[model samples]
Target: MQTPATPKFTTREFRDVLGNFATGIAVVTSRDTEGRPVGCTINSFASVSLDPPLVSFCIDRQAGTFAAFQSHGHFALHFLAEHQEEVSRRFAKAGEDKFGAVEPVAGIGNVPLLSDCLAHLECSVYQRIDAGDHVLILGRVEAFSSRKDLPPLLYFRGRYARVASE
Candidate 1:
């Protein structure tokens, strides 16, 4: 199939288009070279493959903790619940102590896992794909658990939103 010509659009326009779709928020955690904790909030988490039990999340190559995530073979994906907006905001900030106050416990492969999240996914890096300005990290899921009772935190159209239960 022939590819369509690139459309004329600005970065904001592109972001606006993508932002129309709602996605769950997650905090991806890993350790630095010295075993120091590192992480950031991301909305790009998704299931990649079921047969191999793989999941993927995209991280900006220019993010401060991208190097730490790239260096480590394992990391944890914590799905933020509706009540954990503070956790999302905390991790999203640059130059701030994302884990300064909260102490996380080690999960599979010594990766840090946050508490009270809707779910936790412990994974080892399965593959790394460079996609434009972001790095797609495909992880081989070693273990995962979720709280079925909580509503997940979501992002849509440049702001936070929720699913209203009927």
Candidate 2:
């Protein structure tokens, strides 16, 4: 008789394994009280529903941008293109001026959208659920726009990659 395979993995191991699934990179931006831009690179973004237009992403509790996102009540998610890896790295880094070196335009109530993203979504905070080590943020999509010519920036296997056109 053939035996079925058994799986054995830790949380970190599972995360690393799941990282093989390529995802589009995004910069989730919000304005601080002083109206300064705060952004973070998030690969966890996903579309939730179409009827009500909902989207979701997870923010690490320890991330520097967490407070800004929490207090702002609104945010802009800019899905980066394959060429925007530098932009993604800039936002992902700590203690760096993410917007200082990049030109961003104000969209949908002063939310800053990176100039050349594949798509931009302006959203309002809908709800938050506390998960271990991360907070899942649900946003009500207020407005959105996209560019047909752009291809999404992809992340997989701990690196940034691009999709090749057929």
Candidate 3:
């Protein structure tokens, strides 16, 4: 195996560089073994495969909800709408009740589904790989919903942005 090369850029520099690329905000939700809901705001989500209907997202290894997501084996990814910045900020924090005000319905494998998103995907854990400082989770999409009328919430350069009306 080839050895990894040393990164010349500082962590802050790397983050700043990547932040130039905009990403849609998402809140990935799941239930713990005891059936309590958990979620976190994530912008690292992506569609991994179309043939098998797979999606993926990265979670910090030290996140408060990490263990629950890893063991539960199911989750739902909610793509936030442009008006859901409060929801995004709420989940982005490390807290016990990320779903405090939001009423989440149960999806596949009892994963909690948030409402009013531009889109959402219900998935089952397909695979988990160790990535630097995070875990890359691949999920098999089981169900999904979309509302084309709603614009997505976006993050760019450490701030929230919007898609201009066409």
Candidate 4:
């Protein structure tokens, strides 16, 4: 087999290219060992399977909430509504109280569930895959809720965006 040539683009270049594809914003929340709510914003979430009801998201290894997610083994993924850009920005920051302003309800495994999202998925960690600079967390959906009437919060080109209504 012939070896493939290395890409000429830098990491920033690749990431900029990837920004062309729009994605929904989600806040993944879980409790630390002390039972305190911990969460972070993610745009890389996707449904993996239907029969088993699996969803997956990538967490940066260096994130503040990475340890909580690795140890807790359960979490709630909240798909933010179009008006929740501040919610997304809040969780995206590091080393601050993420749940201080937001109200949280206890979920399965005591994961923190954020209110007013377009959708919510309560899940248990099904598998963890080690990927470059990040860990892929595969979760088995235990419970879920959604509101089809709400438009989704989207991220595109490193900025929050909204979908056009017909």
Candidate 5:
């Protein structure tokens, strides 16, 4: 069957529309073969399934961490706490020492898990697919932990926000 044509929007318009959806921020981190830490700030992480314990996140096609994440075989996803905006900014910067300003612990096969996140997941890459300008990486969850007292950092409308309790 032929695909139906969808209305197209400018990149800025598209971003604005997508920004309306609130998402939790996370840093997806892995080490290169040389053991150098590589990571990127990601807002596209989500639970894919529970039966087999799978999760997924999107990495931009041009991100510096893409190759390392693909070749490293394993990685850790640290869910940012509301107070960790600096950590997110550090990871998002290009050509900067992301780990220098933060503390990380090697866990689950040497993947670096940032200290004091709201939660973290250590995973092994299970599958990958190219989609538009990003690659969707599916990981099989190997380990995970959460802190009950922490609130998550949220991204919405191109800004950071906290989820307020009613």
Candidate 6:
């Protein structure tokens, strides 16, 4: 079968449409050559396969952490809780020192893992694909953890949102 052409949605429209879907917030963390922390806020995290335990997330082409993540070969994903919204926003900024206030310890190959996150996944770079203005990073999970008592931070309608009670 022939594939259909790409849809002609404007950038803003595409963003708005995607924002309608609620997603959990996460921080993708790595370390530099000097072992300094490097990370960025990302909401594009998702699991891909279960048998081999694979996951993926997207990073903007211009993000400062891009180089580190691309070369470091390992990283960690921290699923944020509702109380960690500030941590999310701090890392979202392009060049800010987001980790100055938070103390994160090393995990799997010294990837920085923040404390008190809803969940943590330590992964090694499995694949990297360049797509338009972003790069899709596929990671093979080697270690993981979760805190069942915390509520997750969510993103919807282009802003951070709280999970509602049942």
* Models sorted by TM-score, best on top: 3, 4, 1, 5, 6, 2
Winner on TM-score between 3 and 5 is 3
Local accuracy of candidate 1 as per-residue lDDT tens digits, 1-166: 9998887998899999999999999999999999989999999999989999999999999999989988999999999999999999999999898898898988998988999999999999999999999999999999999999999999999999887987
Residues 21-88, model 3: lDDT tens digits: 99999999998878899999999999999989999999999999999988998999999999999999
Position 152, candidate 3: lDDT: 89
* 12 Cα displacement, candidate 3 (Å): 0.5
lDDT score of residue 40 within candidate 1? 96
Clashing pairs in 5: none
Which segments of model 5 are wrong by more than 4 Å? 1-7
Write candidate 2's Cα lDDT for 1-166 as tens digits.
Answer: 9896666778789989889899999999988888888999999999998989999999999998888877888899989998899999998999888888687888776888888889999999999999889999999999999999988899999999889889
lDDT: which is higher, 4 or 5? 4
What Cα-based lDDT does every candidate model obtain? 0.94, 0.89, 0.94, 0.94, 0.91, 0.93
lDDT of 1 at 72: 96
Off by over 4 Å in 2: 1-8
Candidate 1: TM-score? 0.95
- List ranges where model 4 is wrong by over 4 Å: 1-6
Candidate number that wins on lDDT, 4 or 6: 4
lDDT of 2: 0.89
Please give the range of 10 consecutive residues that has the lowest summed lDDT in model 3: 94-103
Q: Please write out the lDDT profile of model 6 over residues 1-166, one tens digit for every residue.
A: 9998878988899899889999999999999877789999999999999989999999888888888888898999999999998999999998888889788888999998899999999999999999888899999999999999999999999898997899
Q: Which tens-of-lDDT digit does each residue in 31-121 have in candidate 4?
A: 9999889999999899999989999999999998889989998999999999999999999999989888777999999998998899999
- In candidate 5, where is summed lDDT lowest over 10 consecutive residues? 100-109
For all predicted structures, in order, the TM-scores are 0.95, 0.90, 0.95, 0.95, 0.94, 0.93
